[model samples]
Target: MAVDDFNRADSNDLGVNWTESDYSTPNSLRILNNRLRMGEANGIAHYNGTFADDQYVEATVTGMQFGDGQTGIAVRVSGSQGGFSAYAAILWPVSGRVRLYKYVSAWIVADAQVELANVPYTLLTDGVLQFSTVKIAAIGATIKVYIDSVEVISVSDNSIASGNPGLIARSSYWVELDDWTGQSLSYDITADAVTNGSITPAGVTSVVGGGSQMYAITPDSGYGIFDVLIDSVSVGAVSSYNFTNVAEAHTISATFGPLMGQRALLKIRPENCGHITINDNSPQYWFQHGDNIVIEPVPDAVYALKLYVSDFPDAALTTGEPDSLPDEFHSCIVDFACYALSMKLKKWKQAAKYYNIYVKNLTQRRKDYIDRKAEKRAIHQIPNNIKYGGTRQ
Candidate 1:
């Protein structure tokens, strides 16, 4: 990384570290009042050092006053001062436009090989003088432009692959550039996970050259983290991992296994009662060794069991037998049954009285069912990606 705050004695010569566009015109670009000021209408200057192929250049540009031209930062600058090939992130104050360009020979628009991307930007406030930090990054085949810490343009082009970092003032010389910084960019870190587990940020993620990234591993229900692998090497059963000062591409994966304590325990008995039908299918059941029973079909994996039945029982329950319906809904069933009994006895007046009571009870029961289902939908809703299927409640 290289940084220059331009805190130097006021001089027409920009020192040995910089290469100016015009060597004959010394005063066109100079350091004044600790700031690098571009006095000429279309002056360009670049640092002498060449950074990595994937690098960035950033500087704080202060517009001394409103101007009609553009000022920008450039990356991957190659060739001499006149025939330089580079990518630039430019800001136009008058039109509030930020543009990314690929230049081949000069700062003129006709000299640009391609207009990569552009976005609107507000460079100044109504009254206050505005200072915006401009950044231009060229990593691999991609180029990203940022103004005031906000990304304005990102495009992929492999035109120019290497060069030095620099500053540009195309007819916008009334600007002071400071806090210039240039550094190599970071690489992408791709993460993945298999069934029964997940890795946070489970996709391609970029990390700064000397920055850190932390990832959390979580296992699904009835499962435990079995192993974690970083760059295809086992890292044990870690719940989380951190990458410090990431400088290259990396890959991570996680695996899970069934939790032994939560495994499905089968304890079946002889089938004394009749078979139950589910969705019009009757699964066979039989007695096994010594009072042990096994059902014909069951899910191989751990899953929730949900049973849905008619609102009312098909037959009357025996004395002391519990009803499947909740206690509150039991009265409505009894009222409807009484109405049916009165009609069977050929008592018209009594049947009408019982039917009226049953209708009122049925209305209230229907309302209660709606309210109960709504409550379950709100509190016990399941995500679409869950492994097992079940009712809301």
Candidate 2:
């Protein structure tokens, strides 16, 4: 029930719906001795309907009069007569190679050939009447080619999902095709995701045995893929996955988690001239640089400094921009500037007040960060109280 025969009374009466296109000349296809003969042109003869996802198309090359060209079976043919696309499993008798090619937009584009095999099959011996059976099987994203019932090439691609089946011949050649047939099978696909992310085509999809489907995972803001699981086995942190030649149902899931301790720029301005310290440690300080002030942490000072502290050594009363601090704590920059200005003016009482405010705001900022992290962990079902050293409780 899976095979369809192509040999009938004539080319038009081949018992299956079919259409042909001559890339070089018109009326290049004819029926001779109950076989489809392609005459001196590069073109394709496409079946006028779609095939199952998991299917195979095969034909026997009965006569190839020229050794310079190639002929083969075309599968998953899509588009119009002038510009169509399909995967071709071809035999080049001159080169003694069996190759898989993708025909697109009225041209046989180069380098798109998926190599299959190389064998001397006497396809162009002129009067020798040698023949070879070429078969192409599409199982999900996997494409496999067989010559004379022996597996030749197998490759994975999700490009052409399902399309019509056909025959193709290239350039100044006479090739005879007979005993063309096609068959189909069945399969299933499924998708899922863990917290903070979603998967496209988010449910089960039914397809033929050789068909393919592409799935993409999108993580929410501040989240990234932790891992991807296919049938309970890890496949690393990939955002996209393609299922091919699925013979049975499958479950694909992606897990996402918050990206830990993301940092942003924080600009700090010092108010007076004095040696400055951050979290009780001195930082690299600069006086002036093109109408701007720059202060950088000493090497390895980032780990020693407090998460919310943004102090730098005193240099000029102008603004100083520090790099790589969390964005949420940016408001504390003004408080620190005021505290430094108060200290420079020798206003001890005012300096103490602003410093206290800066400490309070910094503490609140840290608390907010921790609270947000705890909420994210709850949403992702991760344990919130897992102990850690330093400022990350």
Q: What local distance difference test score does each model get?
A: 0.62, 0.59
How well does candidate 2 score on lDDT at residue 185? 56
Give the distance in Å from residue 89's predicted Cα in candidate 2 to where it truly belongs: 1.2
Put down candidate 1 lDDT per residue, 302-382, tens digits, no spaces.
222222221332322234423355566567667655654443332345645664564445445544553566332111111
Alpha carbon lDDT at 325, candidate 2 = 40
TM-score for all models, in order of appearance: 0.49, 0.44
Candidate 1 clashing pairs? none
**Model 2 worst lDDT window (10 residues):** 378-387
Residue 249 of candidate 2: its Cα lDDT? 75
lDDT comparing candidate 2 with the true structure: 0.59
